[model samples]
Target: MGLLDGRTAIITGAASGNGAAIARLLAAEGASVALLDIDGGGAANQAAAISDDTGAPVFGARCDVTHAADVEAAVFQTLETFGRIDVLVNNAGILLDTPLPGLDMTAWERTLAVNLTGPLRFIDTVAPAMIAQGEGGAIINITSIGGSLGFASYAAYCASKAGLMGVTRAAALALAPHRIRVNAVAPGIIHTEMTRGLYADPAALAEITAKIPLGYVGEAVEVAKTVLYLACDLSSYVTGTELTVDAGYVAQ
Candidate 1:
């Protein structure tokens, strides 16, 4: 049997990149997945591909994580389709990289909305149902090393991820009694479309690699595996923690 057999999972921003990887992996492990993203077209395509590959039921829905209505609707749709929610992975985020001096308030707000408040909104929408199920659930937030380590030109992204960490801890504590586990994954220099622009600059890529003991970028599946572990029964006793999948970048 697969690790997530008979479970239902909701993955935000699952159209592509790390989120899509996680969705595909979870489905492979026997979970019914609902792919949520603002990009409905991409999400639908991803869902179709996963269904074809895994022969598992996968659904897709458009969601703007920052909006309560969107989040609520998405959660409701998942429940309507799957009957119950066993896991929630908040993986939707955008980098609004800007130094403090040149930072735009609008960009900052957008970053916080998607990176921080979006997860909060999803939790708010899903927590009660999870509690009602009385079987507990898992909430995995996709944070970043930037949340803990300061980086140049990433003020807003860093701040939002840090805030997400805070949310993870607080929610973990509050939901423990109900058996709902909340945790976070802080990825370092994962090769994704989000980071493609940065990798375009050789200097930036070199600078990022220099900090990692692995001396190379990580892959989406590596991060997805960590997320899968956290979401599965393998982590039944784990909660309120940040799992850093940065290839020893934070060690230095």
Candidate 2:
């Protein structure tokens, strides 16, 4: 049997990249996955692909994590379809590389809304149901190494992720009694659609790869595997922790 047999998961921003990889991996491990993305069509397509590949129950919907109503509706839809939610992966985020002087307040606000508040909404909407089920659950937040490390021109992004790390810890403490474990997976320089710009420039890619003690860029599946570990019973005793999947980038 798979590690996540009989479990159900909701993964945000799952249309592509790390989110998609997470969804696919969870489904392979026997979890019913609900893919939520701003791009509903893309999410649906991905869900269909994973379901076809793994023969697992997977579906997709349009969900804007910044909006409470959207998040609530999507959670409801997942519950109705999968019957119960055992895992929640808050993986939706945007990167805004802006320095201090030209920093856009609007961009900063949007980043917090999507990166920080978004996870709050999902946790708020799902926590109660998870409690009612009485089996305990796992909530995995997709934070970033940027959350703990300084990055030039990434003021808002760094701040938002750091805030999410705080949220993960607080929620973990608050929900431990109910047996719900909250944790975060902070990724380093992973080459995804979100970081396509850096990969597009050979110099930038080389510069980033050089910083990693692993001596290479990380992949979406590598991060997804970490999410899998947290989502499964393997990390049952783990909570309120931030697991960094940065190829030892921040160790230096």
Which candidate number maximizes lDDT? 2
**Candidate 2 clash pair list:** none
Model 2 worst lDDT run, 10 consecutive residues: 96-105
Query: Could you give candidate 2's per-residue lDDT for residues 52-120 as a string of tens digits?
Result: 999999999999999989999999999999899999999999998778788799999999999999999
Model 2 C-alpha lDDT versus the unseen true structure? 0.96
List where candidate 1 sits over 4 angstroms from the true fold. none
User: Clash totals for all models, in order?
Assistant: 0, 0
Question: What TM-score does candidate 1 reach?
Answer: 0.97
lDDT of each: 0.95, 0.96
- By TM-score, the best candidate is 2
TM-score of each prediction: 0.97, 0.99
lDDT (Cα, tens digit) per residue for candidate 1, span 1-252: 999999999999999899999999999999999999999999999999999999998998899898888888998899999999999999999987678787799999999999999999899889999999999999999999999999889899999999999999999999999999999999998999999986899999898788789889999999999999999999999999999999998888
